[model samples]
Target: MIGTSEIILIFGIVIFWIPVILLIYLSIRYLINRSKKVHEEKTALDILKERYAKGEITKEEFEEIKKTLDSA
Candidate 1:
């Protein structure tokens, strides 16, 4: 049979680990989300290049926009 002291000790251990586990889980989740955000984010120049490659914009327009972006 479990005694009061053992029960208290078990409860204390569980209480201690709860926060430790939560911190680790949160850290991992934060890192994963941070990495996903980085991967999904795209620069304006990258989008411009994609559009130019698709022939959606003329070379002159591409150069004009690129110049505006560079100056800004």
Candidate 2:
């Protein structure tokens, strides 16, 4: 029952929406990755602070480690 025009229209719609769908997917993925990185950085910083508080590392050592962590 479908004509050539109908087939072309369906293909056209799909082509138009494919990139939009991909873009949305990529954006969500990027945001999730960014948030995860931030969480990991915070966790590392917390652990470093805890170590410093516990006297496991010297002040200079803590400062060096913190600088490395923040840079990453």
Among the numbered candidates, top lDDT falls to 1
Q: Per-residue lDDT for 1-72 in model 2, tens only? A: 999999999999999999999999999999999999987765888899999999999999999999999999
Q: Write the per-residue lDDT of candidate 1 for residues 1-72, one digit (tens) a residue.
A: 999999999999999999999999999999999999999988899999999999999999999999999999
Per-structure clash totals for the candidates: 0, 0
Question: What's the TM-score of each model vs. the native?
Answer: 0.70, 0.58
| Candidate of highest TM-score | 1
lDDT scores in order: 0.97, 0.96
Model 2, global lDDT = 0.96
Q: What RMSD does model 2 have?
A: 6.0
Q: How far does residue 60 in candidate 1 sit from its true spot (Å)?
A: 2.9
Q: Evaluate model 1: give its TM-score.
A: 0.70
Clashing pairs in 2: none
Candidate 2 vs. true structure, TM-score:
0.58
